[model samples]
Target: NWRSRIVFLLKTNSSKPMLHLIGNRPSADAVNQWAESLDKLLNGTTVFSIFLKSEFCKENIEFWTACEDFKMLTSRKARASKASNIYEEFIKSEAPQEINLDLHIRNDIIENLQEPATTSFLAAQVKIYSLMENNSYPRFIHSNLYKKLCAAARQEVKYNKS
Candidate 1:
C-alpha cells in the first residue's frame, strides 16, 4: 500500500466521489470526507479538486490531499522519495502550482527533506487543508459547476426510472 501512497502525489483519481453536503460528518457513502463543514454550504469530496480544474488555485486541494496520503505511508523509503517530489511540485517557490506557506514551514520542509519523514509536509498540508476548508470548499458549493452537476444527476435519476 505504501507504493500506492507514494506516487499518489502524481496521480488523480477521477472516479473519486463528490459529496454535496453541508456538515462535517458525511453520509455512509461519502467516499472521502472532510473533517468539518464548509460555511453551511458544502462538506467535502475527494473529487472536488476536479471541479476546480479550470481555476488557478485548483491544485491546492489535491496537493494537500496527496500530502495527507503520503503521510499515511508505512514505508520510510517511500516517504523519503515522495516527500521530495511533493515539495518539488507543490511547495517550491517556482513549482507549477506553488502553495502559499510560511517561510518557516518551507525551511522546516527543506530540513525534513534531508531525512524525509512521513510527516515532512505536515505543516504545509495543514495550511492547504485550512485554505480549502475555509475558502475553496465554500466557494465551490455556490459555484455553478456544482449546481449544474447536481441538476444533471437529478435528471439522470428521473430519466432512469422513466
Candidate 2:
C-alpha cells in the first residue's frame, strides 16, 4: 500500500510544473552540466534526484551527498559522529539505505569506524559514485524526464529573449 502511494505521488507530481519539481527553471547550461559529471549533476538540481527515486535507487545519491558533506567537517568530533551515522545508514549490513559495496570496502569502513575520520567512507563513496556515473547517469540522460527538462529549459531561453 505504501509503495502504491509513493507511485501515485510520483505519477501525480510528474506532470506538475517544472518549478515544482526543481525549484527553478533550470538553464540549458545547467542541464548540460549534469551530463558532464556526477558532481555537477548532483550540485545543479534535484530533478536527477527525483529521477533516481523513480528508479528506486535514490540511496546511492543520498549516500554520495552525505559523504560530500561529511568530508567538509573540520572538527574531529563532528567527523566521528557523522561517520557513524553514515555507516549505519549506508554502509552497515541491512542498513535502512544500505548501498551496494564490495565486502572488503565495507569491512574496511567498519574498521575505520573505530577512529572515524573524514575519509572513513571515501572508498565506499567512490564506489557508489562510479556505479551511478556508469549506470544511472546514462539512463537519466536518455529518460523522458531529462528530455522534458531540456525542452522546458529551451522554452525558458526562448521566453527570456522575447
Q: Least lDDT summed over 10 consecutive residues: which range in candidate 1?
A: 26-35
Clashing pairs in 2: none
Cα-based RMSD of the predictions, in order? 9.4, 4.4
TM-scores, one per candidate: 0.66, 0.84
- What is the model-wide C-alpha lDDT for candidate 2? 0.79
Q: lDDT per model, in order?
A: 0.62, 0.79
Q: What digit string (tens of lDDT, one per residue) describes model 1 on residues 88-151?
A: 8888899987889999999999888878877788888888878877777777666554444454
- Those runs of model 1 whose alpha carbons end farther than 4 Å from true positions after fitting are 1-47, 156-162
Report backbone clashes per prediction: 0, 0
lDDT tens digits, residue span 74-138, model 2: 98889889999998899889999999999999999989887887788888888998999999999
Worst 10 residues of 2 by lDDT: 1-10
Error of 2 at 80 (Å): 1.2
